[model samples]
Target: MESGGWTIKKRSNSSNDSLSREYVAETGCLSIVVLGASGDLAKKKTFPALFNLYRQRFLNPDEGHIFGYARTKISDDELRNRIRGNLVPGKGASGEQLEEVSKFLQLIRYVSGSYDSEEGFRLLDKEISKHEFSKNTKEGSSRRLFYLALPPSVYPSVCKMIRNCCMNKSDLGGWTRIVVEKPFGKDLDSSEQLSAQIGELFDEQQIYRIDHYLGKELVQNLLVLRFANRFFLPLWNRDNIDNVQIVFREDFGTEGRGGYFDEYGIIRDIIQNHLLQILCLIAMEKPISLTPEHIRDEKVKVLQSVLPIKDEEVFLGQYDGYTDDPTVPDNSNTPTFATMILRIHNERWEGVPFILKAGKALNSRKAEIRIQFKTVPGDIFKCQKQGRNEIVIRLQPSEAIYMKVTVKQPGLEMSTIQSELDLSYQQRYQGVTIPEAYERLILDTIRGDQQHFVRRDELKAAWEIFTPLLHRIDNGEVKPIPYRPGSRGPEEADQLLERAGYVLTHGYSWVPPTL
Candidate 1:
């Protein structure tokens, strides 16, 4: 099957010039307001992404500007210089390209504002308006985007204040969208309440729920790999597919996020949002079209159709406290890790078990999806034959897709051995720079494509799948099995899968390095 939009091709000399000129020409009048200007995400992701987009001519000249909002009293030059240091280009970034990115950096400005005050928001509106004009020389209102990169505790207040004073007055005649970062809520009820409050100000369509995982090239390729391939469709059911395994593990511990980690734990922090979203992409029925609503609808259906997990089948783990540079509190119950088994009740995967695992501070760092197919029934063995077919979609450290199938061993020997058919960006594609998660997400918001963006119902459904486990974790009714920092999670994680006749191969290789 032909790859979707991900197949990178050499940009012809003319095409490269066209794209560069496009960047130069379209740097039109558009405005981006980052609510948490001094935060890490703003410094590392927001400015760099806008600069890259601008450098790529994704924005026209004089087309837009960026506003960084914080309580700090830094000058525009200070902000520009600070962001410039972080704007180092990805591989293959030419000096000319870096120069282009620096030019876009000039379009950025800063504003001082208290997140909760009307005066602060009013001042912000004034700043945006003043930048929108070229002293009566520029015409037409620019598109406006407000990105909330703040902690969840203050998301609601900041969003409410912005809507009331800043964004409410904008008449861009183009579009206005608000981007809300992750950890949607403490639980389902809270997420629902927060959603209601935000919905009061911005329409659901205008709210972009950010989950960086959806922005990965290969993660997006999941949809293409499934729907675009005619070969996999007929055998994608329980009868032919044995099980699905998703692993999202980090090599390092909470990195001083212990305070926040203590509140949400692993189940809510990763499983509820990141891992479940990945599961939906893998297990959901194909949508009629690639529109955001249709795709999310299918994902929600998969979540709703999943059979509830029984007490014995679910496994949870917590890492031993670490005295890292960012101190982790002693006696912290925050799980750095968790493993879960979900059985789908739908017709397609009636008996298949979807094993999900994710954690922080592990033995190694790795993320991927493994699809184990049913072995050929009543196979005639050439020798001591035990053939298994597996397809793995690796997401990080290295991005690639590999499939294992039995092949005849070369030589006169009629022996069969498992061999891999692999496709990895690093090995196959040259001079290609894959975009960061935020870059793709920001572009999607601008392109009006919600296909990769999460919607309200999808979030609600995801919370439903994990709400019981959340309560169990909170009440201490569910005892968390403990594991050391430099190892795969508690032995229980392995047993959870072992009891179901499966083993977690390569668990050692998947541990994060910080462990």
Candidate 2:
């Protein structure tokens, strides 16, 4: 049956063959359950993505349903209003866009209840079943997707509730899947425990641990950029590359969110998940195939090669006035920024430094993977530094790929200057709206694609690489340096790079093009 722009294809009731990763999401009777539907993540990201999918005709509200589950006793109108406030359609939203939103909200129903109780889940199941029954699916056609937007502290209880009361009893007809949001537990032990809890309810195939960075357009393109293009294959190694830096900087601080911000420092919040995922794409060996397992296996190998960061290799800092927020402890030592060097033990990246840097309230708001290549060995242009080539992959503000190349200055003097071969997504794909990170990932979750999601072992491997450093910070073995709230993160970050023989961006400031 055709629903809006997308045709909802039904799976056969007696098909013995398993669905391909891409085929897992192609169902007409889809009911998406958003666990923390009233929280900030649900309102700000979950709903907006669903609304966009509906507006773009990728989701048909008439055929699909969205269940908003939360403890708040909000009316349907209140929930819609909250979602509307967070959604800011690109400049051209008009009559069609406004109409689409109104229609999309009709498909969303809010269920107010506790995350741990059976009664609430039963109510949720009834709401879901009512929608499913209305479709009168023959069998093996209706599918359910659960998204956990709540805190990790409640993951186990939520999973238990779903298994005990809400899960589809048989994959004989339609399947059931769950999408998990991160910091995927604090460290190794917590992550394992959470995994165990979810494991008890759902098999690995039923779980998708999502990381938003993997959904970014530029990040998703890393594989093609490296493998498809011959230009990079030869030089993509420690031999030709000087150092690699994956950076995430935010110009704004926690902004009174100390309650949430103080719980996990910048390391767990950004570097360990987002920044590290980018590194996997940038450094992992090419997989034999593009299958989900194949791709995930490569990421695991990359993580496995990483050596634990030493105390001296890490730099931590807390932004000033962090304690001024009442939610934060007066003497809290939680870090707002961290810069750590990861050395891959494998031969290809043996001596190469994968510098993962992230911070809140810094010089700019951007996430990028900068690949700095070794300087040309011999250059007749004995000018200042005989410039090194750098590939900059911007992941936010605007998505883009640009490379620094040395060229002769326009003047009569035989001078060299750096210029870019640009491919800014906005200019390159004019009028094309690149979906938000959450939107793409949500669609993937529905589709049952695990290519971009984090696997259980991958999580443990990443935690292993950073657990020691985290212990140091938590145990007071190291104190985070204090930096002014609005400045670039601690000055030591600069010294670390310089000490590692990194030549900073000299003349050009890597700025995202105005979208």
Candidate 3:
């Protein structure tokens, strides 16, 4: 369908034969069940993404239905009303767009249900089955997708409930899949335990461990940028690259989620999953093929190549007034900010440092990957004083990819100044709506594409790399240094960055271009 400046082709119902047979089921009646529908994730991300798909006609109203299951006791209309405002269209939405939003809202039916109780799940199943039968889809030919947006603590019991009461009636040309949110577990052992519980109920192909960062446009562009481009093939390794930085910064703290944030610090909340996934894309060897399994294999190799994190190269911080949150304990040792250096013990990245940093209540909000290349070896012009070449990929706040280079000052002084070759998405792709991370990911789930999702073994390798450090932090062996709320995180983090070979680019900032 063509709308705005983009054309979204309707996804084919025929499955790819190369993928596992279980996932090769014909796309029949699609029933999307959102568990924890009353939670923030559902209203903020899940529902909004589904609404986008519906608006684009990717979701067929004739064969698709949405069911919201949660512990909150509310009628379908009440649930719709709760999310109606959030399902808003772009600025200056016309009456037709408003009507489309209303029509999408009507497809959602709410079923109040506890996570672990059999009765609640049975009722949810009954509602889903009713919707399926009402469509008169062929017997044993209906697709079911369950999205678990709740905490990891409830995953096991919820999976069991889903297996027992909510699976499709038959396996013939029909499938049941579950999409799980992250902070998968506190550490390696716990992650494995949770994995085993869910694994018993569903096959690997049926479970999608989603990391929204993987769905970002720039992140999704990593493979094409690295493998498809001739310019980066040789310059992407330790030989030409000095250091790589993957950073996530949020201008606000955990306002109402202090209780939950206290349990998982910045490392678990952002670095372990989001930043690491970006790192894998930046560092992994080119896969033999673009198949989901092939791509994931390369990611696992990258994670497995990560060397142990060093204490001297790590910095942790907690913003001032974090303890003021009523839900947070007075003595909570959680770190709202962290900076750590990871070395990959592989041929391509042997001496290069992968600096990962994340923080809350900082100076600004943005996530980006900066790849700083080495200084020119034979520079008679002495451009070294200006700055080294770098490629910065901004993941949010006006997405972009730009290359920093030393260029002659406009005045013919023969002196060099730093400038960039910018590809800011908003400016370059005007009037084109870049799909949200959740929107792309949810569409992938419906299409049975696991390329962006974390595989089982990939998850295991990621946790293994951080489990030791997480344990140390949890045991009070490594305490966080306190920093002011509006300021950049503890100064020690900057020192760590320098020590890890990251050169500071003084007096230069690349601003996103305004249209």
Candidate 4:
């Protein structure tokens, strides 16, 4: 098959026979339309990711053209210049790499339009069609990918415009797909309504619900770590695991995003989608195969097995001076921090507590999944004194997976100390540049892979688990406790963790090893 200028031929290798096949689009020119091109998300993530893909040759410069669509009236050059500062070159980048950035910027074209009107979309479609027809490709062989970087409020109308004015004209091998960003909705009913709005215009297969966390390197490795490892197979259940904690923390508060942050808070912004997706992967049973359907089927089952969150198991907090932001209301009950325990009523995790914790303006900045193992039934050396066995998967700020185990102290007199079996990505994979989450996900969308993107049923199940709790917070039935900005969330959160059977190792900290 021909993609842009590159040829992809299938090879029958024994090692690759079991690997999932890549879905290549039909022979044609490709057009990527960024709907909210004037927005911050477009400038910071969307364009940069596309630039990286172009640099890596995953996007063919000759055939792929990017169209930036928004209400802001800016020339193509102005749009390019707005995003140029963010297209940073990697360390030790050569002159050729800098030149490539310039070339990638040239592929972007800008169009001014309203999200709800057909006039802008018609002009946008005309631009895309002209590009598609300019290529020496066969009729009905063009691919169109629409990325909606706008807010959820505009999604329905924008989607209506796309369906009415921007759909692919040919019914041949060509296709049109739309990628929508989260938060999908504020609650369950709203999400369903939003889904119905889009579902009217496109099929489920054409809609890609993106959650950036699934593209994280460590989060992507969860399946292989669980199913491929012999040692973890038997120990990953209620029998040997004590508690699992998925945590997200940031040292800085909502700087200027108080208006937006005030609406979603920590739970809707982080826990409901990002952290919950990680939880599904951690607790889900292995799928029968690596197909997208099989994997998502298992994830839905995990979500369904989650028991309702109890009031006692939940803790919410707002950092000090949060309301001081001009955009946030003084009487806002929003939570900048939250720690909640989710229990799965399945055989593998029946009795184990899956702790989901996320907070802003905290003591540190990091995201990690900590799986603490049960202590040995009869401890001969009192290994539990050091710490319970733990497998810590750091998701950001230096990706690594380390196993904390009790090791004999390196001295004549035998004593136990906790040490790690570490696999730090930077140290282990020296020259490798891990792709950004947006970079990988954008490539997946282009390749027609729905493995990492959320399915509609999956989104529904996710909303189901958090809607009741969210409504209570909305009604002021549950209030947020106040805590100092630089401190770890409310003291009650740690107490909740302890109540959930998490054993904190007092005198030990595992630092990421340097070269």
Please identify which of the two predictions, 1 or 4, would achieve the higher TM-score against the true structure.
4
Question: 1-515 in candidate 2: lDDT tens per residue?
Answer: 35321333444555552332225334447889998998899988888988877777677766688899999999888888888766657568888777777778888898999988899999998888888778865454567889999888999999999888887756656668888889788888998999998998889998989888888888889998998888789899989998999999999888878888888889989999988888898899999988889999999999999987877788999988888889999989899999889999997898998888999888778888889988786777864374578999888877889998888899999888888888998877989988888988887777667888999999999999888888888888889899987788889988997776678756766555665
What is the per-residue lDDT of model 1 for residues 1-515, given as tens digits with 9 covering 90 to 100? 10111111223457534222111112224568887887888998887777666666565545356888988888888888888767865777888877776777777778887888888888888877776665231333345789888887787888888778766343424456899999888888998988888888888889899999899888988988998889989988888888888898888887777766778888877778877888898889989876678888999899899877888878877777643435455655556688888898988988888988898788878899989887677777642244467888999877888887677879997877776787877767767888888888987776556778789988888888778878877887887667798788788788887775453333122222231
Q: Please, what is the whole-model Cα lDDT of each candidate in the order they appear?
A: 0.76, 0.84, 0.88, 0.90
- Could you give the candidate ranking by lDDT, starting with the highest? 4, 3, 2, 1
Q: What ranges in model 4 sit over 4 Å off?
A: 4-20, 90-94
Residue 167 of model 2 has an lDDT of: 77
| Model 4 C-alpha lDDT per residue in residues 201-233, reported as the tens digit of each score | 999999999999999889999998999889889
Task: Give the candidate order by descending TM-score.
Answer: 4, 3, 2, 1
The C-alpha local distance difference test score for the whole of candidate 3 amounts to 0.88
Count of clashing pairs, candidate 3: 0
Model 3, residue pairs in steric clash: none
> What lDDT tens digits, residue by residue, belong to model 3 across residues 1-515?
32111223544456653223233335457889999998889999999999987887667676678999999999999999888878876678889988998999989999997887899999988998887778776657778899998989999999999999988888777789999999788889999999999999999999999999999889998988898879789788888999999999999999899998998989999999999999999999988988889999999999998989988888999999999999999998899999999999989999999999999999999999999998889998877766789999999888999999888888957887889999999999998988889989987887778999999899999999999999999899999999998888899999998888788776689988988
On the 0 to 100 scale, the lDDT of residue 71 in model 1 is 81
Cα RMSD, model 3: 3.8
